[model samples]
Target: MPSHPSPPARSAVVVPYAPDAPPPQLAPLAGPDRPGGPAVPERWNAVDRSAHAPHLVAVPGADATEWIAAALVTARPGTSYLKIVDALGDVPAAVGAVLETARRRGLAQVKWEGWTTTAEEATALGFTPLRTPPGAEGPDSGYIRRLYGAEPAAPPYYAQTTHFTCGAVTALVARAHAGALPGEALDRDAELTLWRAATNFPACEPVGLGVAVHRAWPSAPVTVFLDTEDPVLLDHLPEAEQEWRAALQRLSRADAERSGTPVDPRRLSLPEIRAALDRGGHVLLLVSLATLQGFDVPHWILCHGTVPGAVVVDDPWAHAPAGDTWVDAHLLPVPDASLDAMSVLSPARFRGAVHIAPASTGP
Candidate 1:
């Protein structure tokens, strides 16, 4: 896949609040049209309209008085992830209300990018700082609070250096889990080398990525699953690009064979991926980021475990601030249904996956 252009950063719209007001009582705002509520800002409205399942939290004055703070939030469509997009007045109180609401709603995680609370305040409220990806600067970084008590051990996170290198990062994450590479070794030098070895440069194919992993650690077992029945990109690309893609696939297969890695013709299902994680294997999944971030691009994510109703993922893109904090993309919970939809690329309608295990595990 060609490198995707980075999306423009969304600036946080900060609404000024009254300097002095009585401490407020936090509650869920009934709807956008609740009577006697604080007026919703235009940015909040925009986010609400665009979000998957939007909700509002309000900090009303004590004794059923007046609205002191309000915020717009939504569950990331197809996932149990909740994001706090915009707020007005008493941000901390409003944030607390949102967190409570999310807990009640059974959301797995909560992320707030433009938080007004200090580190101490956020920690006191159960939020851990989120990390920003390397070489990317943003002000929207905030905290991530895991609602579920199940915290499975996960491989070290390696943020992609470029938009197109997520596949390589996914591979590195898998390698870290397999004990072939240390998580701290995923620096620029390592990333570039792995990118060159795994990617068909600009387009990282499943087979090619597996081949690179096998070559790097022959002891580790790698299984590459390609959706041969579905000619996803081939059906949509221009003739020249299609031919280029075909050549790349052919080369990737050849490399896999030469490197002694196993290439299987299979389309993985949700259960299979979950089972793989259960069996102590990490998965490098090719998914569409549009499902999560509203950007239509081929992306890669690492699956390490499964909760009761969601898959735990380590996304390579750190769109948050707080610079390498706890919730940047660590153990994110995506509902099974949403993961299924994201697994199949749009229009292209094909799925790709790579399962890797440590040397001791047999295929």
Candidate 2:
């Protein structure tokens, strides 16, 4: 867990909410200023609401002996890593209860993004600093406790500099994780370069992105799954724009064929996505941001791990103004059934995905 900037200044103000099972995901600890505008930096207004909205939540302990004040860090629905920024309590039960409530409601996973809690009490509550990404453990700083038994391994987070390059960024992250590209080299240049290689002008068609990854490292074994042969990701474009983009997609399909990148016509089911990951593969999943985010548009995310009934994905579009950070994007859980429905890319309801596996061995 790399040290993120500490959450905004905390006041003891606690908002009243359901103390027992369910809790509102948005009630952030700080951001006295709500509405955050667009893409602003260091502003927590996106999640904050109203001038008097209390950032802290008081969850009564199981025994009802004490009321624990917790800062609900990331308030996302089923497909997010719900985070509780911090909680003031002798025991972790207060925040722990929040986590349990989130899980019961089918949030993919949860994190205790510490702000005020001490290491002794945090570790005692099954909260731990992340090591794969270098949690840099100890009480001296904010250590996260990821709830749910999902693995902590995450490809380093890379925020998409441009709005439409999520597919490119996602493929690059897969390349970095599979040792095809230096993780440190995943900068703006790399992002645009890959997008230029893979994009059908701007939107990343599945075949084009797959071809780019396979071309970057042939041994990485890229396979794309798209249900339709007709040009996709061009529905919103006008007639002439759709014509050119559709041509580019056909060319991409040709490229994939030449590069030996298999393009399966069948839709990649959620179980297949999980199976690829279980075999130690990374997936660039095409999804509509409507269910995950408020907007309805085609987006790409990297699927790297799986929990009990869900698959974990690392999304690249980190909206800073929305009070979203890499912590929000990094390896969050998405339930199996929900992921199936969210992965669709068009009005046609066909979904897309690219599976990249480790280099094959044995002649």
Candidate 3:
């Protein structure tokens, strides 16, 4: 994470306004003020800024010479989640004001990302450091403050070993949630073994991940729903790469048939996916990151909770700005409509998912 100039003296107090209040238009801090900040991160220019615009707030100083801090109480775009994106101001006070507004808005949790401050600062503001994956080390970590009394049971997070290993990581998270794999083993040797089994090398297929889980724990039942009609790989690849993808696709299908894993003819509906989660099952969902980020690649995420009109996912990939990159993708709320649109592979039009649970609980 790059360093930035220390914010102006913490003399001003944070103040919050109604959601419908007009947002303050603060000038972008000059390079000197930002210091070592990146030139421009993706989140700085999100596709839908209005959706992520935070609740309007102003931090005023008693004297005219003191700088007035500008802040927004906003949620991540594309989901009903809350976070505080602060500017040159007092972080602690900003967090305090955000929590008050969150409580008033009936939000259960609040997150702070790329916190340049110390852990003591966060704790003082009632935020707890989030758990990071094993063997992972970086300054771009985040903290979560749960406003509700009891916290939901979220699946443990596992960072993918490679760019194409998201499917394997997603499967490992589901296994950990089901107690098939010990919690500690998720970040160590066991993770490598699972990745090897789940991956189809260059590309991980839905059937491959299901077969891998079944092989690791026979007692854990696995159900796969694949769009066999259009098993699309990267369409932009050259002829040679396309042929290689075709070979991997064929291999995946043959392996699924050999393992006797039942493959549904169509994609799983949002309602059916919700029901599976209600029954304590975790789903390894295939989606296009291009829909969320600009990356045009097939990505895998673990679906563990379903709210009214949204799905809570644990994405293995973190595409946030610097000092927040690769943080825990814990219980990210994605609208059901956006998820449905992202489920199908672009150009290829293929859809697939794998559901895993304890064998004792029938599907």
State every prediction's TM-score relative to the real structure.
Answer: 0.76, 0.77, 0.74
Ranking by lDDT: 1, 2, 3
Q: Residue-wise lDDT of candidate 2 within 1-363, one digit each (tens)?
A: 443222222223345432242243333322234322222212233343221222444555454544444444444444645565445442344565555555556665556544455667556666565422322221223345444443746677677888889999898888787667887788889989889989887788899999998887777778899999788888888898999888888899888878889999999888888888887898899988776666788899999988888888888875544444555566677888778888876688888889888777210
Give candidate 3's whole-model lDDT.
0.64
TM-score of 1: 0.76
Winning candidate number (TM-score): 2
Best by lDDT: 1
Clashes of each: 11, 1, 3
lDDT of 2 at 63: 41
lDDT of each: 0.67, 0.66, 0.64
Of the pair 1 and 3, which is ahead by TM-score?
A: 1
